[model samples]
Target: MSPRPFDHVVGKNLTSVKFPVVAGLPGPEGLKTHLRGHLLRMSNVGALRVLVTGATGYIGGRLVPRLLEAGHQVRVLVRDPAKIRSVPWADGVEIARGDLTDAASLREPFRDIDVVYYLVHSMNSDGDFEEAERRSAENVASAARDAAVGRIVYLGGLHEHSDRLSTHLRSRTQVGEILIDSGVPTMVLQAGVVIGAGSASFEMIRHLTNRLPVMTTPRWVNNHIQPIAVGDVLHYLAAAATAATSESRTYDIGGPDVLRYGEMMQIYAEVAGLARRRILVLPVLTPKLAGMWIGLVTPVPLSIGRALIESLSTDAVAYEHDIDAIIAAPSGGLTPYRDAVALALRNAENTEAGWDGAAADPLPTDPAWTGEIVYTESRDAVVRADPQRVWEALLHWSSRHGHWTVENKQEPTLLELHGPGRARLQWRIESVTPARTRLHQHASYIPKGLPGQLYWLGLKPLHRIGLRRAMQSVIKESEGRR
Candidate 1:
């Protein structure tokens, strides 16, 4: 990177930034983008006024801020207004309450929009998801056309152009066709599995690879897939808004590496520092059976697992690289599969910022007893003081204590203590009700072998005593504070 661009990388840890590198152009580029967008937002000059659906979803949530940094005027449309009330960027954009399935509801939001970003989709819903997806896309198309919207940018899934496409990919492709025929200029950037924290496709891969040491997998594990980084997807989506293209079209976008589905899992294991997983591909396993197995073993929900598995049943490698013409590649390049997974893992260090990490470790959401046997002990108490007071009290206790260091903290909410080798102590503070707070302390240890097991056994009683004393001291200090 040039010195001018690298200079913009100051005041931020490039590694821990939300978007890890397409191998750190994402971080520095992200910073540079933010600087430019901030200036544009301040001047209110030459900004693209756009409306985005799915603002609360994984991609939309990340994209909204990027659009803002690009100095674009963003308006988010949602069925429920409260869904976006607490987001960091909520105050920065206009929020319109409307249902995409209801064409009448979309007309108002679609009006006066230079670009319409159709990022919403009905995935794994209770009703007919395909019909819902189609109707929603149709409504968006008609509304954009009637409102004379300048551009339509839709993020769809990549798949081989075949009648045999799975239900999920077929619906995605159909939605693209509907938008392209809407008499409005649309650019459908179809991407394969997007690798990032909080992405559904990536989450499925993370959980499955982390938890299962061995998999009795489906035949689709052999299917070729091209996975794109979330940053790259956002990059293309942002560019799609500005590119002065000739006509409405669909373009396939992906990372530099393409590999089989099972290969993705093993690569994730390598990135995550886990033992290579064992696998036995059986022809007898169907998508339904495998999905059920995934649901049982991993944190991914059954409906989504089934849909994702079905999509993976066929090769999803990008058929072309036509998108290179409109938007130049990232400064470094697109994040390769290994680098993307590394970025995802690196981003996991900030679990306080709503990143669901520790797929190979332990998760609060994963099914109980899914992976290796982990021993944990938890203690909870209601405190009379507030969270901040309790945190201060805990800090005081830690300062007086020995052999413990602050591993990570979320201020008055969570404080983590890092111990030697896989032994962890977590203190979670929550508001039970008005003027009442609950402080929960949890300890977990994953023993390696006989000696490790003996170490845990030896520390078991000492651990209990230490936790009780720490809780007592913190509680005393908290209630004592004014």
Candidate 2:
């Protein structure tokens, strides 16, 4: 098959022209074409205004900042305002509370937007995701057409061949078609497993290798595929909007080399410093079994895991090398799998700013369990002091004690606890209803500066006792009354 024609090349800027699209944009059919031209011209100045859907999503979160950096005014379409608030540019972005399934909410966000990125997909929408995607696409297309939006950009799955497209891939393609059918010039960039921090595919590899000593593989593990770095993917997305000529094109973008899933796992294991274990692949290890095993070990939700594994039967390696014709070679070129893994780990090391990471009150030791070098304890404590007193105790819980740290593969540094002397108690006492104050203690140790019980799992009994005493000394500080 001929490689899909790239309507525009890298660095080419697309401006709207007077066409049938504009002529048809009047009634319920909408004066979308004409409006698109005007909106494009209005945004062509130094500051182009772009609206991004799914701002809180993995791709959306990273893509928003990239757009802003490229000198575009970015607005986000979000279902829930609170979720995207933690984004670094939270204040800068204009958030519109809209859902793809509901066309009514889209009109507000679609108004006066020059380019719309339809990055929203309902993978977890439950029961007929295809229908959900179709409806969402139709709704967005209608709204964009009505609002006279131009240049819809969609990021889709890498399809080796149209005849063998998986349901996921097919639905994604259909979504792009729906947008194009709206008479809006659209550019679709399809890519395979995006390797980067917090990406589902990368996380699957992280947890699977970290938790399991040996993997019982499936047949799909031998399927050939090309994985692209998330950074590269972001570059293409940004490049797509600026390319003047590349409208109404579908570009299959991927890494330089194609490797089987088994090789991919081996590369990951090497980068992670894991043991080169025997991967016993049995023909009978069906997709169902593989999905169950993945769910057991990885952070991937079962439903999504199953869908992902089931789709692995076909090779997703890109056959078309058309992307090279449009854009210049990236400075770093295509990222190797091992290099990608290392970068992702580095990024994971700095995820403290994530909203889900804030600490609550500390508690007492409950039932405890110890891993290879990590110890976990759960406890509930009722202190007679005020919440402020409890907070002080928890904050300083490791101050006087030996810090618990875990020596992992990446760095022989701390896993959970912040460095000593830097731990500050930041909290305000809410309404103190009663004399008894509640506390929830959650302690984590990094294996550098401090010694905690969890970090002594494989150590000698004496070392474990010594560490426990050190920790207890710190916990004792909180026992004092307010």
Task: Tell me, by lDDT, which candidate is best.
Answer: 1
The residue-by-residue lDDT of candidate 1 on 1-482, one tens digit each, is 11111123334544443322322123445544543433233223367788999887777877888889887799999888898877767899999999988888988898777788999866584678889999999888778756656678999999887787888889999999988876566899999998876677888887777667777898998999999998899889988877756357899999999898889999988987778889899999998898888888766788888888888888988898989876789789988899888877673433234423321222222233223334678889999988888888988887876677888889889989877766678899998776678999987776543345568789899878977887887888888943
State every prediction's TM-score relative to the real structure.
Answer: 0.76, 0.73
Q: What is the C-alpha RMSD of each candidate to the true structure, in Å?
A: 11.8, 8.6
lDDT by residue (tens digit), candidate 2, 1-482: 11122222212332333233533456333443355355446544555679999777667777777788777788899888987775568888888899899989889999987778877765452679999899999888788777666568888887656476667777888897777666666777888887775566666665665566677888888899898888788788876665554246677888777888878777877775666645778789988788788877665777667767766767877777777776655686877766766666552323133432211100011011111123333334444655555556544653454543222211211124443422211122232445555444333332311223224345546544654553444336545622
Tell me model 2's lDDT, rounded to 2 decimals: 0.62
- Which residue pairs show backbone clashes in model 1? 21-24, 37-69
Lowest lDDT 10-residue stretch of candidate 1? 1-10
Candidate 2 residue spans exceeding 4 A from truth: 1-36, 347-468, 474-482
> For all candidates, what are the clash counts?
2, 29
lDDT of each: 0.76, 0.62
